[model samples]
Target: MNVVILSRQQAVERVGYSLGLDGSGLNGELSPALVGQALRRATSILAPCARYELERSVRQTLQPLGSPGDVVGPMVQDVLESLIVYRDLLEMRSTADEVWASAEVTIRPAAPSFVKREDGSIAVLGTAGDVITPIPEDLPARLVHRGALRLLVPTSAEPLAPRLQEFGLVELSEKAWLRLPRVEPAGNYVEEWHRRLREAPIGNRPEGLLICKPTRRGTLYRDRWNPAEVGETGLFVARRPQRFGANLWCLVDLQPNSTARIVDLFSTGDTLRSCDVAWQIQMALDARAGLAQAFRCRPNGDRSTIDFFSPIPSWAERRLFLVGRRQAGTGCLYSYEMATTAADGERRFLRESLWLVEQN
Candidate 1:
């Protein structure tokens, strides 16, 4: 995989060139040197430009280079030399701007398909064969505190956010939780709770997305999300030739900086159950990956991009330099725990949404 990775100097030059500082493009209204420096320091992480890795990757994969008369040899060589530059231009997260409080709902996916619509919108093809179109426009921002339980692979589904308030999905004033029913017996307390929820007319509303639906699809999760890739949260970046067959997805910390003051290690702690272990392990990883996506990656126009942290807006971005004043890695981990107690107080389930939203 040829991912464009560049050096500090190279990235600085690229932005400056774009802004017309290096005598390229039209001179911009902003200062090129200052803006270039800002972008370099802006919030991103890129891999080191090691000659050995590049040499090995290119030599082994460039089959045409071995040909007697390869016409595209020089072009390929040029690309190899500038791998770092193109990758440095990729912007990872789009919710760096701000945070908004919205109803946090989690639906168990039997099989979910994320299909890219022709209008640059993404639709969720739910396991039930129902299409949930154009996922909420501001979902990433709303998911600042609540992270996803698991990442769902792209199936051909759809989106459009539901106004939970109108549908009674927002049960509490603080932050409500929504999870579709699974295994619980019908008359059981939790099952009854979910049954009542499933009976809600949430999905029928104009603002409804996959927030509610009563249809029970085929196999538990057949043709839905890829079970094999379930729980595997890893992202690798590289410049593919657009012919890479299928897409490889990874999670991103959509956490914003504003939530940090309220939820540090000291805040979300108690004697019984404190911050989750998984969230603790993920803080550093989120910082690392978010920064990497910020500074090192490529954006090919208005493509469908999913927020791995939350299965909401597969965003569309030409360039994402969060309109903010903070440096990279200041984002904090925020978790909202929602618990449901059975009527008899015998059975209960608690789900947590953990995220790292970038701050301004």
Candidate 2:
């Protein structure tokens, strides 16, 4: 239940941030004192991926869950019961206006359900084994990540599997994603995105170079990035601070339904005209986050979306879940990302999916 996605240009979503997208201090309104200062600044930008989220919650419970302060004392009591279960689902969705009050919807800001979908699918598995299906679907379901998120789901995303058999969650593999095709750019590309945001410039990077740590020296993901390519196997990178020049990026372990994937990229040099002006200033910031064009995939499946509320049916259709790995002759890491979710529809936001280190 480590859900941190609060965009709409009042940003907040970082683990290893720097794929260009910044400005957040919560002033976009929605008080509770800015939702307790945006949940204490998203729990301090997810405390450097807390031991890479406790080693992906200990390989989804493959046993031996002790020490390390006894599994961080129940992962800090399931992150305070996932903030009291999203503050009682935002007080029962603001008094059960229980279905976004009747229609023509347009409220946006829906994640209130202890948002957890590190990869989606796996909707419940109790019987003392616990994984109460996708983080607190309500009713005492304490969780963190176990039950092999059912080997990366994709039985059309239902993944039940759980008949109890001591430390289970074995399914090996099965996760194929698709749906990518959206192109509409060329309308003077907004005057070349205001002349490259008026000629971008700022990030400094070069303080002894090795700023890509996290290899507790074991092997398979010690806390990520010891050379994490292959579309960052379930990513988690955080290095976004220097005037974020060139839209610096790296902050996405986010996946709450409108799924996604596209890891690492900050380009400014590495040839190919710095990767075509860093992918034309990220499609001019994905055309001001409404998205229109950006598709160049090869890694399981390609996808893109803005999905203008597909004739609502309780809304939920905007995807871009990618996964890469094509080393061969090297030179292959151009990226893209865009998000927008709906449970009550009317453009719930999530833009700033990044990747582009200009390595041609």
Candidate 3:
């Protein structure tokens, strides 16, 4: 019983696209539109390396050819090829979700769910049941790289090994589970999160999510003439034993209908002044967005909101910034909204918010 779902039109569209027939219309051997969404996500994860390659190529092309538009075409085409597999991959996820909801299956979050520390004690979590009675010394490598030892996805109630083999170990399964190194939230941070949740006003719990120590800071500004430092902006949270704080920023290029938004919230002993985090937000608001201009936010004491001239439409380019320190477990966030044009002429909306979570 192979319960896979697919649209013939999508396949035809993708095939045509994969063959470099971008403007050949949808009546081809493949359907790009049908597969475009999944392709984008899968290619994003699997061929993320391609992005670096494309960027490198662009840099080279720009210097010799000096035409940004000319270089963009080839780079975008390369990205499209790398992402075509996303269509099937997304279908798989969708199928798995439906199957899990309706079937008699108990999926464990972690598989081979036990590991032995140096003390020779076992650690197990999830329903897989002390999978490794005697922990192996090489267990950490497997845990980090191998992902769940088993999965009962709906398409097949079988464990994941065979599927992993088919998908290509390094490309599909391994990269999907590679965890970005991040700082562990401190005990004080955990307590503060609890306090915030506990003191939530009847219906006013924090509406967005917060990630602590997301990544090291990075900037997109490559020109020396550009005043912004490449590593000086981003989104991140700083957490301490009993407190947590957020510093959000947006670098230069603020224009209309940008897809990115910035919000900074933190719990600190020292009171926050507008001067501390406002400049970062100001940068985001000033980014470029084709013809549309971004909404500006003015900080009034402790709170502020951005009222845009109009919402950024879908499929717009957006840049986001997040910076954090693992040792200190603190950071900031930045976002940018890209300008988009609708095929049918519609409005754009690019809005993002932030929130926090506590560890159990």
Candidate 4:
């Protein structure tokens, strides 16, 4: 896919300019500087000023480019740039003032004659297909780490070293294992955990994000989460994506952002059984994917201004990014994973939702 940014004058109206990249928009009120910084960051990441092998390196560069008043203006720019790899598929992850979790869910495609409703919603065509429903109005727009699982860390010389070895755990030389005190119900528990971590007294120690998994194998429920599934009883930790697409379709992001990470996982459905990182990312966003439709990415503005030659609203002034694949026809099967974090250390995980099986 190709992307073109606006010129200097358009950049001024579209994104403006900033000196204190970090501090640009820190005031109680929003300002053009802040807006510009965001736009610039979005442009750099979505469209990308540069691409690098390691995302961490990109973050290092961006930490200094924060908007005015933000001492880290230039650095932030670098970080955003590092995360630009996912710009093509609209799979950029972001962790700014708010966290937005989204996915593209696909059902079997129908006949060509099927039509979308006036409001831009697609419907099932036949009386038999009538059982199919439109996208839910209250569809979940975000994914939160509702809870975590904490397990006891054996304390001894060799301790659980043998178990770690058996499980292929990669031991971090000096980090101490903090026992997972207990498991709580899903509602509001994550916020409580984070709050407690923030208030931990001096000398108190904790390591890594508190991960929650299944406690038992059979039919699983949220409240009765089993740790063995999501966490490592050994030293090695398993990473998973929050959503996914099949080989035929590419995953796309509705909103683009800087510093996003994409990955791939196993499995064809929304269930969390098999997912992982360390795979190729899709670099094209299929305009026909559910995500594009959900984000209203298609041109919907007045016909006179349907500027296909111009940048779309999603990429006009801010950082625009995407990640996914491109293949001929449909009926392809691939998997992907992604995550995003902000300058403030906020993080968002994109777990694979389902496989995208294109209809012929």
**If scored against the real structure, what TM-score would every candidate get?**
0.15, 0.22, 0.21, 0.19
Residue 132 CA error for candidate 4 (Å)? Answer: 38
* Candidate 4: residue 53 Cα off by (Å): 5.1
**Deviation of model 3 at 85, angstroms:** 15
Best by lDDT: 2
Quote the lDDT for 247 in model 2: 29
What is the TM-score of candidate 3? 0.21
Q: Candidate 3: where are CA atoms >4 Å away?
A: 1-160, 166-176, 183-360
Model 4, range 1-360, lDDT digits (tens) per residue?
Answer: 888764433333332224222232233333333332343334333331112212234344443333345544344333332222211111222224322222232112121112221222221111112211112222212111111101122233323334433433333221111111223322233233234334433321111222222232222223332222322332111232223322211111111221111122323332211212101111002121222111111122321111011112222111111121111122112111112212111111111111112211
* Candidate no. 2 TM-score: 0.22
Across residues 116-149, which tens digit of lDDT does each residue of candidate 2 receive?
A: 1334532222111112222323221222222111
Lowest lDDT 10-residue stretch of candidate 1:
316-325
lDDT of each: 0.23, 0.27, 0.26, 0.23
Error of 3 at 44 (Å): 15
Candidate 2 deviant stretches above 4 angstroms = 1-183, 190-192, 195-318, 322-331, 334-360
Q: Per-candidate RMSD vs. true structure? A: 23.9, 20.5, 21.8, 26.4
Candidates sorted on TM-score, descending: 2, 3, 4, 1
The lowest-lDDT stretch of 10 consecutive residues in candidate 2 is 309-318
